[model samples]
Target: MLGGLWEWWRRRRLLVDASFAAPLLLLAVFYQGELDQGIYGFPGVGFLGYWALHAGLLLPLVWRRRWPRATFAIIALACFGQWLLHVPLMAGDVAVLYGLYTVTAYCSFRWSLAAVLVTLLGAVLEAAQLANLPREFRWAVMFLSAVCVGVWLLGLHMRTRRAYLRSLEERAERLERERGNELQVARAAERARIARELHDVVAHNVSVIVVQADGAAFTLDTDPDRARKALETISETGRTALAEMRRLVGVLRENAHESGDGYAPQPGVEQLAELVDQMHRSGLPVTLTVDGTPIEVSEGRQLTIFRVVQEALTNTLKHGGPRAAARVTVRYAPDAIEVRVSDDGRGAAAPDDGRGHGLVGMRERVAVYGGRVRAAPRPGGGFEVIARIPVREEART
Candidate 1:
């Protein structure tokens, strides 16, 4: 119960109203007799007039935070009116100092400085009238000056502290928004990579299957043995394609909150020979050569190399004529690995507009490891794709 009441009292409106009322109640009880004495140089107003003036000075403070300039103006006018009428200072006069502090805290610095100057001048004028008591007048002016300056400085300190806290909150909010944007961009790039992986895996294997199936159909009656061999090759190609597709689909399923326990591992550099053999079985004879000692490569970089080679050969099989042949050369340099895929076929020029999705995917993959690729028609009569990928020494065993 006490805690609840304390929270209620801490509210601004309740606290302001209470501050206005408490002084009025205290003055009515303790200072009524002194006020009634009507000392010389003080206003000779009756009880009703004194109470009216006191209320006018203190009541405007209730809206000080909402209308700081207006409230301070009213309080200053009241103070000047009392001085003009020669009214004695009452307990409620402290509200003028509180009004000045509020104006400094809530209003702009120029307005607060203006209020300070006016209050200081009023204090000096009030002090001058008491020349008969020089010591008391000096002390009074010093005390009033100290109080006005101290309260205004305190209000300025509070304003600066509040502004610093607001800046910190705004900076935190902006950083959070930037972090959210970065996360969205990362997710989009991951999805695009996954799509490219699926396309390269499915397209290459299906094209081989179609070519082998057509060959088996054409030779079914004339050469039973050859047809049986072609059917066997198609079965193997279909199974490999199915396994790879399942792994890619499993990744998608895992991302969608499904089981991914049976997924296969991604192919890398070690599997390059198997890929070449598969192409050879599809009736596109290929020759692969390696130069210099092989060094250990990161799985991601190895995958990039494998995919580039796979896409290049797949394009050759799709576009190269029946009698075409391909040569794949890999050179391991001290600082980089270079690959060249050349085919002796009816080579056509690559599109100048860069609209080929397969080439785009290869470029994107190579770019991940700061590599470069070039695909164009050879000078004589073939298509060639060359890629060079940089390697870090620490990435090797």
Candidate 2:
């Protein structure tokens, strides 16, 4: 509530300043009226001059912040004229101090310094004007000079503080912009990764379904049992592909589940045996072997290994001939884990299409763990994919 009030006043400052100046003008007019009526021993100043002088002294204060230099100039001129014409003491003169403050805080110190000099000069002339006054009364000039310097210093302090606050606000804005940019980059990278996962899942599983469906169609009558088995493989492969899709899509969801059932966890190294068994049923005839003790790796690294093997064998299914067979070897080292997928198939005949992104995805995933992937045709025949994911020393078994 206080914050709202301060903001409201800030917007209407000109009206507030005018309101302050109105009271001062009224108070001075009352005193000037008494002085004009011979209520004191001082010489009577005319009503016209009194109104003219006091208005010039205080009314300009309304615009002191908006046009501080012009306001101070008008007030300083009237203040000097008040002394030259022997005007009686009025509260309107105090506006000069406020005008000087506005010039110091809103304008530069170099400009306010001249107002300080003029005020000092006025103090000396005021001392001279009250020459017959007592020593204690005359000492008021020193007090007035101190007040002038004190207000000037206060304005200077406010100016420095305001500048510092402005600089801090600008710095905060710059940091916010940088943070927004970083989030956009991270979001883009994540979307690209999800795209790669989708491609690998769909391409691999769809290829298995196509192979099984083609075999079932060819042997539907002559080999009824083999046809039934191929149809079963197709159904199971479709369900597996759907599960993989849900796992990937769950990453984008807020509730982490669909239809009141939790999504399946991601495929990892432990699931390799099941994956190989499914591939054998799909007519891909893949053999799996593991070497050395497995290390305790992060889920992301394990997913990297699984996806690399999946993409390599999927490519072999698409390009390897009917008689082809594949071997997947997982070698566990102290500092690294490796998956080498090689197929004894006619891999050299595979199209070198620049459109393929499976290898690209494999490289991107392994690169996250400071690892590398090598994919190329074997010396005599077939194709091989070796992805080595570095294991942190602490994760070594």
Candidate 3:
């Protein structure tokens, strides 16, 4: 029951009505004589009469938090009227200190200061009249001024502390949001890398197997030896593709453990020979050329070049005619590496445009390492794909 009452006092509209009503309740319960002494002043009206007067004056205080200036004015007027009527001195008027503090914390600085000065001046004069001290009684007026001033300064400090706390909370919340965004960006980049690997592995290797298997079936009756060779090539190419794919995908598993020493090494340009052999055995006439000494490149750039070549060959097998032949050339330079893949096919002679996942994967790969790729029909004939990857002077590939 007491908890409920306390909650109501803290939250209800009755707080305004009961701000002074509470004191009146106490006065009625405790005060017995018409004129008496208690915790409050005496020698005039009894404690009950003085409390009644203060409660009536505080009727306006219910609105203090809402209308501070009006409440202050009302309280000041009540006190001045009591002095005029010669009512016994009452300490209940001390509630003005709290009301003044609220006004100082919420109102403009100048207005709050002016209100404090006016109230202190009135309090000093009232105290001097009510309590007749020795000749040094004037010193009491100064003491009253000091007490009111101290209360006003306390209110200012509380307001400053509250504002400081609010600023710190806002800074912490902003930092949390920034950290979340950075994590999301990192996740999105890793996912795109995985997708490119998947397309290169599945599409390129699968296309080669299909072509080789078809040739083996066609030659089984007429040429048993050639048929066996085609079947063998299909088996070898499929296994190599699966191995490469496993290496790339292992990083994606949540609990995947790296080698005790470090991460696995990535495949680079040296692996192109094995790739070309797979296409030759699939019955596509392919030419391979390397101009300068092979040099090392970053894992990301190496994988990108490898996938571009793989996709180009896959497209040739899928779209090139029966007699189509492909030529692949890798040229190393002082500051960059150039890769070219072209096929003398009679089918739609345009190199893979940005259409199927094959072409899309190639483009995404090239873009990641700051490389440029151009796929178009060769001016003479057939389709051609050209890629140039810029490298640091000290870097090699």
Candidate 4:
């Protein structure tokens, strides 16, 4: 609280300068008679002139901070005029040092240097007026000169300190902005990861349940056994989805390590056969074919490949007609892996609301590996999904 008020007071520069000049103005009025009398016989414009000179010296100080060079020039001219007329120095003459300090603090180094030379010259010339008091003149002038130089030095120090503080404040603000941006980026990345997981879990499993339920409804009166099988598939798919939902909730609620791999390892090449078999049970015909020697890759890259294939096949099962068939092909190369899923169905003619994010999610996953995905309706009355993910040497399992 005190610091805040102190800063507030500093910002009221004009008010502060006025307060500084108040005491000097009072001294110039009441204390001029206390100094030694002038040498000239002529009073030189009488009492009003003295008051005017005193006001001129002090009043300009109110603008010292805003107009340092001008303020100092006006005050210095009045002080020199008073000295040339042999008006013995008064108490308010201290404003001369204050003006020099302002010039040093706010003006360029050149102006500050000139101010110091002028002040030192005035001090020597004033001391010479008291040449009869030789013992005190030298010391008094030396002391005055030292005070003037010291005040100038103090002003320079103040300028340097203010500049340093400003630099620190600027740096702090920059870091705060950068930190906020980084947090936004991290949150966006996390949201994307959660989105991909939800798509994989909910879309594929719910579609299976939906397909099986439809099948059971159609076969209920015609074939009891087929209906029973369809109902069982629906039940199984629902339970699997429920289990996955629980796992996702647990991962969100606890630390990843605390969950103890509760995220559940995602299916990769080893599970493709099972995926094919599962599709068969769902009444979709899919053929899985692998080309080139299988290369071991990290779980993350494997998961990427798996999601691409999973999204493609799920899309196929949902869109492909009862008689449509899909072919799954996995090709491996020295530097990359490709998964191609194509279905001979209604192709782009399939009824879609255009709200699906399956293909977009697949593209995002593949792009993270500096890869690409092409999902389009094939020319020959079919739809195709092709994903290629890079396999860096360091990605070996």
TM-score top scorer: 1
Instruction: State TM-scores per candidate.
Output: 0.55, 0.53, 0.45, 0.51
Instruction: Give one digit per residue, the lDDT tens place, for model 2 in 363-394.
Output: 76676566999998998899999998877622
What Cα-based lDDT does every candidate model obtain? 0.76, 0.79, 0.70, 0.77
Name the lDDT value of residue 235 in candidate 1: 93
Best candidate per lDDT, number? 2
Q: Which stretches of candidate 4 lie over 4 Å from their true place?
A: 1-12, 33-45, 132-137, 199-228, 231-397
What is candidate 1's lDDT per residue for 255-283, written digit by digit as tens? Answer: 44334423334587889999999999998
lDDT of 4: 0.77
lDDT of 1 at 376: 88
List RMSD in Å for every model shown. 17.8, 18.6, 20.7, 19.6
Q: By TM-score, how accurate is candidate 1?
A: 0.55
- Per-residue lDDT tens digits for candidate 3, residues 1-397, read 9999888777865475456546744554454333344453454455555666676565666777778777777777777777776765454566577667767876778868987888688767766785677554567677777878988897777767767888889988887787667555445554455544444555666788899999999999999999999999899778656554544553443323333422234456778888899999998888899989877654455766777888899888877778889999999887788999999885355454423456545655665556788887776667889999865422223
Clashing pairs for predicted structure model 4, backbone only: none
